[model samples]
Target: MTRNIWTFITCGLLFSAAAVHAQSADIIISKGTDKTTIDASPFGASDPAGRMFIQVLTADLVRSGWFARGAQGASEYILSGSAGGGGGFVAQCRVAARGRSGTVFDRSYRGDANEVRRLAHEAADDILKALTGRDGMASARIALVGTLSGHKELYMADADGQGLVQLTGHKSVSITPSWHPDGDRLYYTSYAKGFPAIYELNLRGGSIDRVANYAGLNTGGVVSPDGRWMAMILSRDGNPELYVRRMPNGDPVRLTSTRRSAEASPTWSPDSRQIAFVSDMSGRPQVYVVGREGGQPRRLTLRGSENVSPDWGPNGLIAYSSRIGGRYQVCVLDPRSGDVKQITAPDADYEDPSWAPDSRHIAATRSIAYRSSVYLLDTLGDPPVALIDQKGDWTAPAWSPGR
Candidate 1:
């Protein structure tokens, strides 16, 4: 069977001119020489759900690039929590720094039994914020299309690959699941009507609606950060090209005009001014960027045999899958300096890298022996770890932006 090219999947500040410059100059970059060690104490020993919370919290912290799990000996921070209740589980969490000697985070979360994991994730994120002065991805989720039930279906899971829920029951073929910045909605392509069309799934209410149903192709729909524009691929005019359409309902403004070549995988820059997409106009598919208002497109990747699945991150970096030698690997490119860094090893093929909101980790599909599973790669130092232990052919992993 031929590999499906599309199936491989897939900021900003303001300030015055001179006053902003002075403030930016005052910003200091901190360079750390050692990883922060954290000891995560078991949550509720008597409650089964509480124990589950503890397990997930520890795993989430370990997966975070800034922290490591270990004993309290010589530990920089300690996280302890408890969960229990009769009608609903209540989690009381506390985090403290060893040297500072005061409680850094203390809070209580109350919800149904099913919310134990979510409460734990919230505590983990809070701990991260208290320690690193940055947000955490523990509470975030990932959207993907998998073949677990023998058909391509849309599924959503926690960032750690737990709480798997099928978003779409199309049971036909769904691909390219893209999350809105709010993380409550998703846009993807499905063949439920026997033709490729883009559909939006409201995760909160479980409502599905078709967003784009043009004549030819309606795939690779990516909603901008502002939720005002959607950059997608539509071939209604002639050849497959990149186009940006207004949210809800609006005619698309074509961005690419190559008459013979095709384009796929459109992504938006942090400021939503430019879009990075895949194009074959140069004979072989390569990554290219174009303005949202429809202008000339400039090629971005020049060294890879084939470059596709461009994901513009919140940190001003673009992550894509590049074919090196004979295997596909995840590569990050600095659009400003044209510097490229390959993040995956040569032993396995990794594809469809989606950046975590923190911009320090990426979730991608690692394939071996025709079996594919999602793996999270920390951009800093740790080795890639499997996102889930389930058996399935997972692809097109999209990490949710921070809530």
Candidate 2:
């Protein structure tokens, strides 16, 4: 009898261990689709007075919008980070919802003392993606052309519409500013040469260099995330067609073949593997995506009469302006599942929907009731918030990736 009881107890212990292991595996597998409820608090890492790491981590997490910041009550998740001695810091996070622990997401990183802020953001992003299966957008910036005082010039602003600064001093119209992957420079179409031309403007030096000059039209340019190639629309070949050019040296390589369709408003995928742009190949202007290396093109937009200004975000989501219900409105598309969601209704001619760095918000110019203004719509939120009020017209608002 004693031997039998001991055997039973051992078997029960083994079963419990196996169950725990299985639960852990399930959590790991389902993490990508799970939305975690979390709380962030200070974990004992260094001196009590040292909270710089926590500050930076919280800022980064808030900017990412992956989690709803907890106030005081019970939180679904908890995050804590500290910069301790020995030039190393530890960021530990726990996610819990209702009564279940989501996952054990933690990391310890070591780097130069001056890189603490960058490291902090990186650590926060890792924790966020590990727990929530989404990357943080705290380190991205946006480039767009803002019109002021009857002059259209290039302007760079933060993703939240703050810190607006004019990038180009040209009196002519400048539009379609694309940022290099490093966020150190901007390439835009400036009319300084009597026609739309590509110009590379250094953000650090406030210097501008002409990149591509064509006779007919050169506009709607975008740079690859790797900064190796550029995609733009150039009418130099008699009509607007997609063209790819090598950066810094400005070696041109035409990507499209026919003048049957006007290809413009090119936006690159986050991985730099594909390019999405507006084309009239399907008898009308619609959004189409093609491989970067040149191949067959696939149409994405079909429900709308006309769709233009496609902007690809971090995830597989694409934002564009569509003529729905007799007016131009902003719409979003899930490229993976073919799910289309109309964001802006038929009240105004809303165009140029630029995705925020977080991939959760879109910045666009909306014209309603004979007035135009800049608006920021948090796709994950209930609705959008007006960021700027304009009297005449505020068009082409781009959210900066980050500083």
- All candidates' TM-scores? 0.89, 0.69
Report every candidate's CA lDDT.
0.81, 0.68
Question: Considering every candidate listed, which one attains the maximal lDDT?
Answer: 1
Residue 351 of model 1, lDDT score: 94
List model 1 lDDT by residue over 1-403, tens digit each: 1112211211011112213433221111122225788887534545788778778777777777777875755677877767776788877878777778768888888899888888878877877787889888999999987888889998889888989988888889999999888888999999999999999999889899998999999999999998899998999997898888998678888888899899999999999899999999999999999888878889888675799998999999999998976999887877886656666665689999999987888999999988898999765535678887776799889998897
Model 2 per-residue lDDT at 36? 41
Q: Lowest lDDT 10-mer window, candidate 1?
A: 6-15
TM-score of 2: 0.69
Model 1, runs deviating above 4 Å: 1-33, 42-44
lDDT of 1 at 160: 82
